[model samples]
Target: MRRSPWATLTVLALAQFIVVLDVTIVNVALPRIQTDLDFTADGLQWVISAYTLVFGGFLLLGGRAADLLGSRRVFLTGLALFGVTLLVAGLAGTPGALIAARAVQGLGGALMSPAALSILTVTFAHGRQRNIAMGVWGGLAGLGGTLGVVAGGLLVDSLSWRWVFFVNVPVVVALIAATPLIIRAVARRSGHGFDLLGSVLSTAGLLALVYGVVRAEPVGWGSAEVVGCLAAGVVLLAAFVAVEARSAAPLVPLRLFRSRALSSSSGALALNGASFLAMFFLTAIYLQQVRGASALRTGMEILPMGAAAILVAVVTPPLVHRFGTRTVQLCGAALSALSLLLLAGTGADSGYASHLLPGLILFGAGVIAVGVPAQIAAVVDVEHHEAGAASGVVTAFYQVGGALGLALATTLSVSRSHAALADGMAQQQALVEGFHRGLLVAAAFAVVNVVVTLASPRIAPSAEQIAEAAATA
Candidate 1:
């Protein structure tokens, strides 16, 4: 049976929503989870970090699996794993068990996210339809993080924090049931063998990299464990690259990076993710700790950010049609940096309506503008067969960048706060100063992206180029 492209998108979007939602849903519930699970202060961070580490680590494998095994098969398999793990996490009685469940849940997300994206890339032809589809995907991705906060607060306030994990179970079940009916499966491509060595090297390398970066926040960056993990990650990833350069069947095709559009988009997306996620972390802390707002109220306050992102997602494609993608990306990056600069101006007594709303709204709009184009550019010119690999590269960049950003921001924030306390500043004032420093780091990332965007080729591939590339493939 033929399925409407819209129906296919709906199913994919819902699956992705839960995947992205899990990234930040636990933020507001962290304290509750710690209390209930008796998590040590240092151990509590893993509930969030475990998911991030595994999710970022396994994305490349998942994307390649979709290419070799079939996107629909990988998507469904991931969905099932994700659903089961969410159930286990919700019911977990011990801290270790919950963290274990979260780690497996990250694995499921790693598989589902890129597979769904590959499906979308192939389903819609390039041009207006593809832009609109990616716009929706980009918007949903941004909205998921924002909604996670809102949903987390509501669930934790009215129910237990366990509901944060449980809430997605029903959605997962629905997506599993609905997917096959709407989207037909493609047969796996022949003539391509799985690259086992590349898979192991890339996955282990990414896992080590993420683990080191996330761990650096709690442990000093100078610690032996951090230094060892970072060194191992770099060496392993370098080896993975060398292996791919020689392999007949590479896990990630080196040729893909030759496309200036895809390469630039990957880099820009990393900086974009870094800025956006770090900003969220900084603002969330500012709301709860500085203003002393309830979780529910903080979520409500952040609602406008999502609204602005949706608005930009809807409007950006047309702007790209007229102004060109590079223009819009530059403007978006500028706005994002400006938003963070504005946010950095917030004092200990700053009011939400007067001080914070402008930046929040601009951030929402800015991130979507940059993200929608980056998302489109990453897969738009790639051959259909390599769409999964292209998707994985960009998605991996964003996830890894987000993890790095959060870690850096947390370390900077804590260090600044402690320094201020040493100088005998009031606790509230010192905390706000630390948040300011973190916001500046986020703003710096966006500013750096501006330079990155300026240095890259044009955002959209020309029609002639796309055709020639397609013919070449």
Candidate 2:
């Protein structure tokens, strides 16, 4: 029986939104969580780091499982685990319990997010239909980050902090009920069993790498712990590559990288993700430290950016249909760099409407234009079975890149602030100076992406090529 494509899209997109939302939803609630749970300043970061590290680590395994075991099965399993952890975190009696639950939640996100995206590829045939679906999906991916900030502020302010975790219950219940009707089951598999060695190497390598990048902010880049983890991660990732080359059912097929365009697309997505994350971090700081706003106010102030992203996201798919992915991508990157430049010009005295709003809107549109198109190009040439793996890789870039970018930006901000303070600048003045420094670096990243996109061969993959890839998969 054929299911309604739009309905499937809604389910998949909503599932992903909630998963991504969790990434930042707990951020604003941390103060309250700390008060209730006796969390110290140093230990509190674990709330965020635990989830992201595990999430980055397990994404490949989860995506491959969706393909081998079946999307429906993997999706439901992840949903169940996520729901269970949500409840555990909500009802936890101690800081340790909640942190542990959050870690599990990250693993749950790793399992569900890629499987949900994979379902979209098979549900909507490639071309206009898939492009539109991806537009919405990619838009939500962009929106979720901003939405998480706003949603966290709203929930934490109006209700108890526990509500942040508890809010997922009804949504999870509804998704589980709708799963059988909306999701198509994959055919029974006859193949080599799961690649245990590949999964371990990939997961461990990513875990170590993300951890090192994250730790770099507080520990500094040269710390022994950071260096050891990064070195270990490099070695493990290298081993994973060698293992994937030999395995029959590799977690990440090496052939996927055979296309230079696809590989470039992934790298571009990482750069885009890095810029977007760092931009938001700096803006949030501007609102809070410079403007003297509360968490709720900061969230409200950021709302305009998310709205702009949604508007552009809706229109970008059709634009891509008419204009092509490369054109859209290049234009988006150029605009993003401009937006960062505008942001960099601001200071403690800049007004919201005059100085900030224009750039915020530009950034909103810029992220959608670059992100949606880059995602489309990445999977446009892949087969259905490979869709899950491809989705996993794409999302991993977004996750890992965002973490690394935030760490880099945070480090820059701290160093710049210290330098300014040493020169006898006021604390708030020094903070804004740091924000400028970070935004400038982020803009540089956007410029580099534009350069890379221009330098790459124009793929302009046609409808027939897409059809052939789908049929072969």
On lDDT, the candidate that comes out on top is 1
Specify the poorest-scoring 10-residue window by lDDT in model 2.
464-473
Candidate 2 residue-pair clash tally? 0
| Model 2 residue pairs with clashes | none
lDDT of 1 by residue, 1-473 (tens): 78899999999888877787887677777767777889753355567666765777677777778878999999999999999999999999999999899889988988898788778878888767776676577567767977888998898889998999999999999999999999878667665676778767876786676667656756868899999999999999999999999998777789999888788888899899889777886676678778887777777888898889878877876676566668888999999999999999988778788989999999999998888667666776677656656767777788767766766666677678878989999998998988999999999999999998887666555543333222211
Model 2 CA RMSD to the hidden true structure, in angstroms: 3.9
Candidate 2: where are CA atoms >4 Å away? 1-10, 27-53, 89-100, 117-147, 177-186, 214-220, 381-388, 418-425, 461-473
Among all windows of 10 consecutive residues in model 1, the one with the lowest summed lDDT is 464-473
Best by the TM-score measure: 1
Instruction: Report how far residue 198 has shifted in candidate 1, in Å.
Output: 3.0
